[model samples]
Target: MTASARPWVLALGLLTALRLVAAMMLPPAPDEAYYWIWGRALALSYYDHPPMVALWTAAGSGLLGDTALGLRLLGPLSVAVASVLLARAGNALFPASGAGYWAAALLNGTLLFSAGSVLMTPDTPLLVFWCAALWAWVQAHLRQDGRWWLVFGVLAGCALLSKYTAAFLGLGVLIWMIAAPRARHWFRDWRLWAGGILAVVVFSPVLVWNAQHDWVSLVKQGGRAGSVGTGSALRYLGELIGGQIGLATPIIFVLCVAGIAVACRRFWRGDAAAGLLAAATIPAALVFLWQSTGSRVQGNWPAILYPSACLAAAGYLSPRWHRWRRWGISVGLVLTAMVLLQAALAPLPLPRRSDPTLARLGGWQDFANRVEELRLERGASFVAAEEYGLASELALHLPRGTPVIALGDRWDLFNLPEPPPGGRGLLIRSTRRGEAEPLWPQSEPAGEVSRRREGIEAERYRIYNVTVIGDGPRKVALPSRR
Candidate 1:
């Protein structure tokens, strides 16, 4: 209601509106659609990530229905949460200051936060939970209020439930405690122990699910960060740093790294406020930095660091680099605007082999329409896709309750029951980077589906009529899909 709060209000409103429009106008990314389908049948955990994203999506679609707007509702909603929490976090880190405002600005201006506001990925909820926990941690440490510890525990657990990467949040807290001499009492504090117990309890469902499934999720996610390759360590590290730069706008990204270094120094000098910010980011950032040595890390893998990175950058970046801040904001806003337009209109003409965003946007509508026609014309009993992403995309768009299945390991994410043995299907293969051979031996290419963008061919899919010869029903209909 105050004048100062107006900027935050405006930022939140503009972001929410842009994200909502983008979410509705642009089709869901294949991964976003996969998450939405995952939401349809909510589970404690999933093959990909934990159940928090499922919970977030289910809440949105359950109330608003299965439309894109409904599926992506929570993403925009979280923007408001992230905005307010980052503000509070900024104030907590530096009392009676503009740190909060700058933090919120630095965060909202970047594609990391803007694109995430509509994408509905695990990072969506994880961002919300991470910022919330950071705020609570600052309050608990600064006020020495034991009650805030419980809040931190709950938020931390929720972050874990959102993604396994949040384990670094726990590590950060421990590092902060050990590194900060005065904070040693937390080790013996009963409130801390109670909070720890609460976090374990909150995260128990994921543990139970993994236990039932032979700990597959743990092994898979853990194995990703498993072995460190001695070769290409520098190259991987260089990419990780460059990727973070792109994720955060270039100038802001540089400031974020420097801010973290500054905060780490303050932590060593016994600054609790700086320590809270450093603890939230430094440990997680380092883990991913180390991860880059072993694997080809994605550009956004270190997105978890942005909450604290934004806050730290705000407090540190604003003191200097006024012109650089303008450049960063301009670049971020321009890039975001271009993306929104791309999502809405697919105006960009980039190579499909390189940047696939616009290409992904173009082909789906045509693919969906053609696939439906194939089902009716060819009398195909089921829709089979070569990859999990294709299966989910076709499944989500083709029919309300169509029997769409992925050929290989992609089937694990779906909650649908196994088919009743024998069936005939139309196999849709997007020849971008997949194998030419069909998973079923009894299948051959029947025809092709060409999807175009701006009157130019963007994707070519080979359609195959596949049959599983068996004693079951040779003429079975597709399952009544949900």
Candidate 2:
């Protein structure tokens, strides 16, 4: 590695450092909890996502145990890999000395760093695999090397295993080939189609699992997007663009589009690599814009676009912006500072800023512990929940025999073996009720047990301890306490 190569090393190091910083600071989201649960189970597929994320989660847990840092270690490690791949792909596209390094650096400062890099989720792993696949595809395209097609096949397969979102890449690439006269030869290549078969093989398990579950995952995700209409659609698109501004600075986003225009000319002149960046963005943006017409969209739905955008920005800026290197550095620093400040302000209160469904994240484990004490004192049979997310998290931490049951539709995430024995169950809610009627006539509330404070700090519904006084063998009596 020489002078130009040193920047690649520095960029990689910076990405890894940032990942470490975020892993140490950021808390896990509900999705992380769900995936962590998958890790604990070590299943082939999850109800919501494929097993790749579960593998990442398990790796984190195996190394760090079930702590925040443990859950996030793999996520940041993934960002490091994505950064390296981005650098290599950029180098392949441009003739500049350190173009790849600059491309990776530009990616480092965007919201991609925060969401895909810092916050560990299924997408984090998928992004890494996707970047790697794209890099391999570019190499194969440029060198006409048949063997790289097999590499692309394996990576594409892994990307699909990571997330269903990788379909966009195939679609985008296909369109790019059909539209470009010079690259039309890709259709005649046997290895290209062989790669598609490889992706199918890697993704088949999840496909089978979804089939077994009646494709519930697809229905759930589709319903989520379509459920929001008109007003929310407009709002979602606005936020989508807003998120893009934060993730890939407004200036960089603008420059990337211009870069795509310039890259298109090169592609027309048979520079196959130039089309890769534009192919990723143009089609994804079109789809995003189309979806925005009816349903609200998530900003990160098209997160796959970030890598290409980075490449585009590098292309647009290298010629003119590189001339003013000092000015570019100053501007880049200012933009990064502003974005970090915004992310900090955006989620200042942690989980509260994320999702309210989760029990006020603060002191939740303490609450879980208190419930445990009462359950043990009274020798409770099982723990029932009004919500699934909370029930799932509590189940993870609670004593093994203490079954957590979901009383509502949200509990669909958990697969219960059967109802608690004798139709009698212990209800867990955040309220004051000593005893109440159970769902079955045979079951009734026995006594109340719970922890209460001055006010609900995080809008966690009042947790209640209701004893179902019904016909069943008395394991232990609820203590006579207030």
Q: Whose TM-score is greatest here?
A: 1
Question: Pairing residues by index, what is the TM-score of model 1?
Answer: 0.93
How well is each residue in 1-482 modelled by candidate 2, as lDDT tens digits?
77868766885676578557656544455466556666766655666667898898788878887766787788777777777888888887776666777767666655555445666677888888888888888888778786787788889889888877787778877987887676788788898888888888988887887888788776776576456475766776787778777556665566666667777777777766677777877887887777776776676677777778778767655466654433433455465544343343333443434533223234445556767776677666666665445555566556556666545443344443435344334556544222344332343445544322222344333434444443332222111101
- Go through the candidates in order and give each one's C-alpha lDDT: 0.77, 0.65
- Which ranges in model 1 have alpha carbons more than 4 Å from their true place? 228-231, 433-436, 469-482
Best candidate (score: lDDT): 1
Q: Write the per-residue lDDT of candidate 1 for residues 1-482, one digit (tens) a residue.
A: 76877876787787788788888877777787777777876778988899998888788888777667877888888877878888987876777666787777778778888776777889988888888888888888888888888998998999899999888778888988887887778888788878778888899999999998888999998898866666698888898887777778787788788788888787778787778778878777777877887877777678888878878877755456556656777788788778778766866666666546656666676778788888889888888775666776776777666688665654554456665566777888878757656665677879888877666676888888887554222222222224
Give the range where candidate 2 is weakest over 10 consecutive residues by summed lDDT: 473-482
lDDT of 2: 0.65
